[model samples]
Target chain A: MSNIQAYLRPDSLEGALALLAEHQERARPLAGGTSLIFSHPPRVEVLVDLAGAGLDHVEHAETGGVDIGSMTSCSHLATALRGRQLDKSALTDALATLYTPVLRNHITVGGNCVMVYGWSHLPVTMWALDARFMVVSHKAKPRDVDADTFFERHPLRWLGAGELLTQITVKSPAEGSGSAFLKFGRDKSDEGIASVAVSLRLQDEKVASARLVVGSTRPMPQKLDDVAALVVGKRPSKEVFAEAGEAAAKAVVASDNYLGSADYRRHIVASLVRDALAKATQRAGGAA
Target chain B: MKIRLQINGNTRELETTPTRTLLDVLRDAGYYGVKRGCEEGTCGSCVVLMDGEPHMACLIFAPAAVGKAITTIEDPDGDRPHAILRALADAGAVQCGYCIPGMALSAKALLDATPDPNEEEIRGAMEGHLCRCTGYVKQVEAIKRAAELMREEASHE
Candidate 1:
């Protein structure tokens, strides 16, 4: 039996935030708790649950973006997004393909970003979309932190305190921008050996820019800025797109090499990057 | 870890560890319909509806689910009455009968949400629940028949 003495379920954000502000050292907001409860340090005294707080909706903002509440479940995303005007269906598909129906229902979007599991698909997918999260703590008000920059800065680590991740906002894709996510796993439907998330925008069918993020390949998903610049303003035919995929694989190889041989990761990267780019291009094309 | 929870429409308080799973709680409370075939989440024999959504009971922490509503196969009414119990018997989907309860309940979750679920929806909802005896072909057929029957009932209403 856990020695935990008191468990509090707070209903209002202000009340929860006030409690967190007072007990910043010992307080941690619990969502889904798929990983937090099982893999936490032994010093936890108070478990503040956010399940009853009613922060669980996917609201399309009036300003051309979406503010997905931190507690949104992956299974709900899979079921509701079947015919929605989501800019990234491959990312949606990758989420739907998570392990099994049961786990997907329990995992929350906010926890996916905070824990940032190596096996998680959302981090890889959102990385390419230039997603940002709303980080809120009682000590400080709320602030919007860019997803990539926040990881690099390690703001959460610097503070040495738990910050509640309140929301994730992804801007509506531009006219030419298209995004896709893919993973090639050893098990037929299990976690991936390696995965890639790609986003592209073109001007006159010539690649204007691309954002490529590869997953389970390093400490975290690697951003392929150099590889993306290589194909900008170039017409991406089947051959050209294959070259771009090879460039992405090569760039990943140059960065932190995977546990697998450099050649094996490159081979898998080559295929996934190619498929993701092709799918994104088709999505961007839009039969116009 | 003495935890109080509402299980199967009744409040039963039990002592368990933070690590002790909801599967342990239900079984100790005599709700053995929540089978423990595979302690790991891979086997869906422990599938139950937490707050009306089908979830794997083995993976849930007893403390985490303290206040949430949990429904086992014993939760009465709906298609579980006519569709699952009736269809499983008619189509021979209950071989050893170990997997029938979960398969039936998971189908109840699906068919209740969608009165006329297609083959793909039923198959997707039944991903980890396995029946080594039925070969699953007849089980899928049975679930499809259940959906059709539910649809007919919906249409008549």
Candidate 2:
């Protein structure tokens, strides 16, 4: 029999948080149910459905950037991003490479953010964009956690008993900024063995700022600071991107998994990072 | 718990546990068209239209589906087979046919929104369905053909 015994659908966020607080460790936040339902954790006695909590939305923020509700599905996020006519396509491209359309239709951005599954693509994009997560609980005031710090905290284990990620804020890229995401999956259906996301801003045909994030080859997506530093102030060129690729291959930390071996992952990461950088540079040229 | 949901345009009430997936409940309710494959939700065999959007039933909790409009393969208009199904049959896109219902539903969802999608769009739309047989070339052709048929039908109207 399924171990879950209780289901609660609160119409308000406060009510949901209150329920989460009361249930404590026994309550699990349910978003899309794609990830949580499969594990069927023995400790999860109650599911607090966030479907009715008005968390599925994408809107522009007054302070610039975009505020996306945690419950917004990847499909919805892609559509929203396309509609906004933004310069950054890393997140959208990341979502596009994610699971199949049916799964993407149900996989919520919030759940992906919190779950941070090794194969998930959005966290890598978030790392490139320097996104922030807005989390709230029963008693604590709403707080924003930087994407890098959030990933460092080990997302799956970080949330307290009652805390829920309510929103994600992705700041708009600077003018002449371009970003791209690429993944090399073992198969068409499986998650990527190596994935790369690159965001670069150009000034006078030189890299003003750069962020390169590599994921799926490691437990958490890691920003290749060494690689990013090499690209900054460098002119965009095939040679520069190739050097960055080599740097990424050397700097990335990987482990063997069902998808690929560490060596194979290293090779894939290098190639993808090169392609991602080239694409980002080309887009940056256009933006410039 | 007792819940009422709209499936295939019919409102039905059923008794279900909190943990039952929509896939289990739908199959038990005699919707055999909703295939039971990859209960992990990786495979697209259990996909259904939840509020007119394609979603894997295996991943959705039964209680969460209450009050939502659920559409199964059986819900498609029987008298007039959807252009997708017709195209698939015309192109001989079925082999074992285990994945057809889900594929058709995914195609239908796509065609409903984008009547004339390009090859890339078609492939992206049906990426969720895994047909071990036919290799998806025929399926891709069938969806492209379906788009033409849909456009023809719209023009004639």
Candidate 3:
């Protein structure tokens, strides 16, 4: 006799979302079930199946960006993102470097976003692109929220109780914009000790816009606005790159096992920031 | 929970739990071809094709796989057959049989999707599946050869 009391395969997104709302207390939605099933929840009564809900897609929208379905697996997204979704390539390539082919095939893009504790590059890369998620609830309609605020958890707040994230949308970066993502780890499979994603919009070889995000250092991966500000309106020379790195290193904070002392993490921040900046600049056609 | 899944073209119903790893389940089925190198999902020994994608059976809960099809080395040529074994053998990539199944399956899955994988794509696809014997040189060659073989075969059609 097993305790997995029920399994429901909803045929549509709304049906699955409705089931999620109805059974939020006892049931956990399983997309690929790569992470949820591992929790060994105190109560294992139900597995709400989202696989059949027609959400596993990566479609090009008419407006030029991509509409990524919630059920899209990391490996699948990585493949689709290769030459087509270059703006989000940092996230996709990072996904390619995850543990092994096995886990990537099973891990859902939505589940990866929900597991955005810092070891992941998906959330940070998406955040750098200003991507937004469409979350639905027991309420009337689906709503959109920015990546930064969607995952921020307060001290005692258990948020997202009734919401189910549906789709992720990322607009295409301008032709002059470029991005790069890098992750450092103690071992190949060890969760990233430090990760950064840099997005830059260049104007005549000068950084008209820039965003630098760091993960695996704090409770959440966030943009170091100061670092971006340091590079904005400046040509991406070695000096500018070094300054951006230093500014990013200064922003490293303490949280969740970042593999070393705050000072060491800062050093990594500086090094990877420089590396990411140089690469992104080159991707934007700036001379390295 | 007793569920039926097609393991390498063979169907059987087995009692399992969400905590029961695919490695443990496959071991019971006598498919020793699927290695159990790392239980933490780092090693590719526990790799298997679940509905056309290579996956770590260790990370997947068994009951959640109600009607899915699983393919081990036993199902060679079932999903992306010739990409790894044939092309890799043509390229002399088999150093130790230990990592071959996982490597082969990984290569098979990648070449199935993109038959023209470059060096970086090959490295990205085979990131954590370690082959201590060949130093990855031969494995890279094997993937390339496998892609060529796949394309050659596809062109025949």
Candidate 4:
């Protein structure tokens, strides 16, 4: 049985934050309720439901990007992105490949981002895309944190007692730029063993800038700066991508687990990075 | 906590704990068609439609289902078995029958949203269900047959 003793449904974001402030560590905000169902902490005695808080929305940001409310479900986000044709098909693909259709309907962006799991997909995708997170507290003004800083450590460290994530803004992809995400799992429906996300821009048939992130095999998603630097001035080619993959494999520190050994995961990561880079380069109007 | 849930087009007020799952509550309330398999969310045996979208009932807290309309395998099509159920029977898709109820509900939701789903879409809709009895080939064929039956029934109307 759960240790929960109170259920409070707040009609607004302010109301929800106030409740969290009052209850402190004993209260948890429930959005989609997928993760809370499995692991309800013993210290939690109150659940502040966010369903009625009017936070589920996907809107165009003033900065030309899309501002997604934290409560937006994965299925809803996929539909919105597909309908808008926002050049975020990579994100939609990642969401589709994360879990089954039913689970996707109930898992929200906020819950998935806040609850950092090893196999989490969105953090890696967001980090590669250079997205920004909007976090709000009851007593202070809202603050924006870039994906690099937010995911630098466990996201929970950035979130204080009375603070919660409210929105995520993804900058629109530049012209001649494209992104792709790939996850290697035991099966299509299982959690990923290794995943890679690549975003790159092409200029004069050469790689102008690139951002590559690897996750699912590490404790948290991390940017491969050395690997990305290798492709800064080189043209998109099979040899270049393969070399970048080899550098990535050597850079990451993988450990042995029940699913696979450290060497095996490194091999999988190398292959996934190569494939994702090829796809992103193709989308960026480069001949690879 | 006393909560009201709209199940099968009827609103019922029930007294339950805040931590109880919708699957356990509905089963105890005599809606036995909701099968209980893996208590975890991985298995699809406890799937139920909430607000016309299929979700694992075991993953939903009872009080959290206050305002949404819940649908079960029992009486999904008013008086007759749904087209998906008939198609499954016709295609011999049921072997052990443990996963049928959840699969049927998931199929109904899929067809409700998309009337003419293709083979890939059918397989994607039923990916959460794990059936050890018969291989998934028959179930995919059954969903295709169900789509045909539904289209035919709609055209007649």
Candidate 5:
């Protein structure tokens, strides 16, 4: 049962933060309310709803990137990106594969980032895209943290008593860059058993830089740096991609769960990474 | 807490707790058309339209829906069943009928947003719903037919 005693919807971010500070740990910020509805955490006494805070906007940044408010719903983001014909990006692929249209309408970017579930897709995709999270608090000016640093530890640990994530800034993909996200599950709607995201940039038919992140097989998504190093400076080829996949299989700490064995998950990670590399490379104007 | 909700285009005031879901409140207010299957959000049996978008009522707190237009399976068009409902019946899509209310509401929302949705669009819109009978092919076909019927009605208008 929900332990909630008060529901406060403040019209401003400062007001919401003040309410959270006053209530301390007893209050939790409610964005889309999907996670709260699902978990119903027992410790929550007051709910400071962020709906009226006006955080759900998507704007094109001056740097040619996108500044997405934390409260933007998945469907809204998909529509915005699709309008720009960014349908081939990894973020869209991940959003399209998220639960369903109904749930996607209510699932916000902030909720997905703050809640940090192992099977969550956005974090892995964001990490690969080199996104940055903007966080604000009552005591200090807003600070931006790179995705690599944000996902290095539990993101919740970075928040203080009254801090809230404000927006996510995804830098525009560089020239000759392409990214792809893939999830493997028992069924289309089921939570992913193994997921992989690859973002790479090509330079004169050689891999200039790459980011490889894997999710769902472990407690949190992790970047395979060693595997990425193997692909850097190398031409995109089936043999090179296969070697990178083998390296990824050994790099990840795949766990055994009710869904599959650790061995099976590792195999999936290898195959998905290889295929994702091929697709991303092809999009990067490389022969794969 | 007292909250005012616009249900099926009618404003209604109700006394509810902060934690009770919209599904519980609506059903208690005699909106039996909002079926209760899985209390969790996955089943989509308790779906309703909030501001013309399909949302699982079980996952929404009653207070959160205070200012939105809430549409249940009980048609606002009075006694006449919605065209989506009629099409489902005509297509034999309602076997046990447990999932029809939510399914029809989803179909109606889809057709409202997209007057002429293709087969894939219909399937994508109805993917959240789980039905034990009819094998979902009939439901997809019914949505297609419903879209056709809606388009024809629009032509007359």
Candidate 6:
């Protein structure tokens, strides 16, 4: 018999959380089920469907940020973001590159964040934006976890027993900020082999603060602090961008896999980072 | 668990295990058009219109599809072929015919959402399906032809 023994579609969040609390590790929340249905763990006996939990939404905060509900489909988010006249296209562009259109119709934003697959691009972009994750569970008050810290370990193993990610809150970038996302894959339709996202906030035409994230080159998306250190306080120029990319290339310990060799990934990462930085710098100047 | 679904405009009740995928349920229900290629979501052979949107049936748990409208390629116009199917037939887009249903449904969903899609939009909508024979050139032309047919139908209404 299949290990998936029971499916629970709770009409209310409380009902779902209580069920999750009761079942604990035996229960797994079914978000798009793109990842879960493929690899049903032996221990997962109850699949909690959150479709009716009403977690799907994307609301622009009065404070000028966006709150993305966990169940919001990736396609919907991409359409919403594409319609917005944002100063940066990093998040929207990154989303457009994820999976095929049919898959996007099913993959949820929260599922992507929680699953944290190696080729997942949204989390890397979220990390670059310093997005905060809202998680809920029994016996714990809903709390916001920093996106940076949320993936310290593999996210699938990082969630507390029975806990579910509810929403992701991304603060609005400061004025004159620009972000860029770039992914390198075998083909335009293929998953990312290496991806880089860069966000830069410029003040007085100098990079005041910068966030750089590289994905697919490592086990998890990582922040390029060394690259940031090189770019900060420096004027936005091709020279500085290339220097930062070179530094990132040297710093990232890329893996050798079927998609690419470690050496090839390192080289691609440098060029992608350079291109992303250059595009971000140009956008920053325009925004400024 | 037993779940009720509106499949291809008919309300059907299915008794299936919670682990059963919608793909398996639909195929077992005799919707052979819902092909079972790549149990993974990568290939679009199992693509279906769930609540007016294209989704991979292979990835969707059967129970999760309850209370939603599921439209398969077989019943797009309730026995009458959809304009997308007609367009494919006219354009000679089907080769081997395995990927046609998915490609047609994707085009139908795109046209339903955006009636006037450009070449880029057609390619984007059809990006998920893998057709080994056509090189996608004829598929793109078929989608464009489908959109024109749809527009003509709407104008006459």
DockQ scores of all models, one per candidate: 0.46, 0.77, 0.45, 0.83, 0.79, 0.81
Which wins on TM-score, candidate 3 or candidate 4?
A: 4
- Per-residue lDDT of model 2, residues A94-183, tens digit only: 887788888888899988878877888989998898899998999888988998788886786888899999999998767788889998
Cα lDDT for residue A64, candidate 5: 51
Quote the positional error of residue A149 for candidate 4 in Å: 1.1
Per-residue accuracy of model 6 over A115-139 as CA lDDT, tens digit each: 8887788888999888899989987
RMSD of each predicted structure:
3.2, 2.0, 3.7, 1.5, 1.4, 1.5
Residue by residue across B34-152, what tens digits does model 4's lDDT show?
Answer: 98999787879989999999989998889989999999998787888889999999999999998999999999999999999998999999988989999889999999999999999
Clashes of 4: 0
Q: lDDT of all predictions, in order shown?
A: 0.75, 0.87, 0.75, 0.87, 0.88, 0.86
User: Which runs of model 1 end up more than 4 angstroms from their true locations?
Assistant: A1-5, A22-25, A62-64, A79-82, A153-159, A253-262, A286-288, B1-4, B14-19, B78-82, B153-157
Quality of candidate 5 docking, DockQ: 0.79
Top model number, DockQ: 4
Model no. 2, DockQ:
0.77
In the range A62-177, model 1's lDDT, one tens digit per residue, is 54466788888887766555555563455575676677777788888877767665577888887788888887777676888886875553334643355678888877777777
Scoring only the A-chain of each prediction against the true A-chain gives TM-scores of 0.89, 0.95, 0.90, 0.95, 0.96, 0.96
Q: What is the C-alpha interface RMSD of model 4? A: 1.1
Highest lDDT model number: 5
Q: What's the lDDT for residue A129 in model 5?
A: 89
* Per-model B-chain TM-score: 0.89, 0.96, 0.90, 0.97, 0.97, 0.97
TM for every model, in the order presented, reads 0.89, 0.95, 0.85, 0.97, 0.97, 0.97
Cα deviation at B110, candidate 2, in Å, is 1.1
Predicted chain A of candidate 2: TM-score: 0.95
Candidate 2's displacement at residue A14, Å, is 1.0
